[model samples]
Target: MESKTTKKVTRGRPVCEIKQAEQKAKLIFSAKQLLNIKSYSQITIRDIASEASINSAMIKYYFGGKENLFVELIQSIADEQFSQFEDLGEHKKPVYLFIRRFGEILQSHPGIVHLLSEEVLNKTTPLARAFMAAFPARVSKFLPPLIQQETGISDTKKAKLAAFQLITLLVSPYILKTLRQQAWQIDDTEIQGEAWAKDLYRHFIYGLKESNTNEVES
Candidate 1:
């Protein structure tokens, strides 16, 4: 019972949406490639558009501006990393599971730690504030339970400290990747493999034992 024009418009919408999604993805990918070589401040719209092989105006059309695009890219990376954590508690060895999944993310997103350090940890820009607003709640909600389960820590403060230590242990390696390679010849693949995760879990759990026993006693 639809007119030809109405049917045509409905059919055209899906194709338009698909094209828009493709364009946005290209822009995002372009930004990511440029980010690997350049700092966030140094990457411009033209650079991204040139990388993407699209017109420069499309960057604004798709992402509003360069800053927002970068923030969204970082947010997407955080979401990808965080999504891997959901199944951690379900595993028998949650700490090992967490470390392995953490490695997977680092493998998939090389230089992600550097990007995060440059854009979020080292700055107080609007992009940093936006990312902080969106992600910290997710981290707070997810990490504490895993930490408590692994360490058997009943006190909130001690559990928090353990979580901080665990994160530091996981992230510091990647942050110091170059130094780790130069000093020890430990490549990223070795760190991102099951062998390293097992070792890290053993050391971390062993370290927790003294405190866990003391906490139970006192």
Candidate 2:
């Protein structure tokens, strides 16, 4: 029962598993590197493989195709981001910190906005729908409390509306950067950074206070 051949086979299984995991991680890394320089449609399986210095066929073996690979990439990014946002609950200035952190994330991953537009907002494929159901839709539930905390807007409906508006304010600059740049020569640097975040926070707070005042008067 303690034959050397049995022990050899058992030990080999772990090595095999480790190698496969490394290959899969290589593919994912290659995909992310390519995505940074090129649009999703512009990237091919070979490009990722070449960037990774791995065999091209391994892409199909590991991720099935570019679509699934990108989905996994986005999912991984979302998981990290969601965890970071959850940690904001412990921050004293969660609202402003959230806005600044959100802006930095978008700026760092310039391709992510395009991927969202192409995959989730513009299409209703099963993968796209699943992505929305899994991440953004679920994350929406977490924002209203932050809104309520910052603005003292206790009404559930009003807090939810404020949350949606705040997110749109933060995301619009990135989503519309190309058009805004062409039309007004405005750049992302002007709309991002600590100064811009502080300005946004002040404006949002002012608007909420004005609304509360008007409601009291009415």
Candidate 3:
């Protein structure tokens, strides 16, 4: 149907394209699963490609290698996170429900805290510093003021601190997980663990009010 040179080039491109797409998908899936279990330093391009069943070299061809892949993964997660926030922002979700959602998000994306803790929050990497710089501004815009508006806390400082404490409560599970990995094993997402989290959430919320609020405490 075409000249020899043209046919060779045309056929080659499609094969390359298909291979590229497969490699990309493999890397993405592998990263997501591995991220849930290990720290970033423990993750390698070779490991990802091997897990994805592709040549390690293919990772470069498709995702521009490990750093870009990590950035892309963060962006994908941020997009999904913002979408969840948007959905919640539209509803008058109960305080404990909102707290539970924060925990659930962190639980499902355990790697976020691990990475953020190691890199940005820990001053371990310049890349983490860059990510952390914008994180507070972004989170502040949506969380604290929103909490104040919802709970009628006119004190801006208190509202912001409350929001941070709430996130800390949500994040406590991951912290516990990291600590326990050194010795004891704890599953913060388990029913017993979740009940404790709810109690803490309710306990903390009580302090944000004038006199009365949810008495549910851990």
Which candidate gets the maximum TM-score versus the true structure? Answer: 2
Residue 82 in model 1: shift from native, Å? 2.3
Please write out the lDDT profile of model 3 over residues 129-173, one tens digit for every residue.
545543444666678767776677777887788888777766655
Per-candidate TM-scores read 0.82, 0.86, 0.74
Error of 3 at 202 (Å): 1.7
The worst-scoring run of ten residues by lDDT in candidate 2 lies at 6-15
Residue-by-residue lDDT tens digits, candidate 1, 109-162: 654665666777867997888667655556666666787887767777777677
Clashes of each: 0, 0, 0
Pairs that collide, model 1: none
Candidate 2 residue lDDT tens string, 1-218? 77565344332222577888887787787787777768777898889888988877777766787788877887777777777787777777788888888888888887777666655677887658767865667558887888777667779998888888988888887777778899989888899889999999999878987997789789
Q: Which stretches of candidate 1 lie over 4 Å from their true place?
A: 1-15, 133-137
lDDT (C-alpha) at residue 188 in model 1: 79
Runs in model 2 lying further than 4 Å from the true structure:
1-15
lDDT computed for candidate 2: 0.78
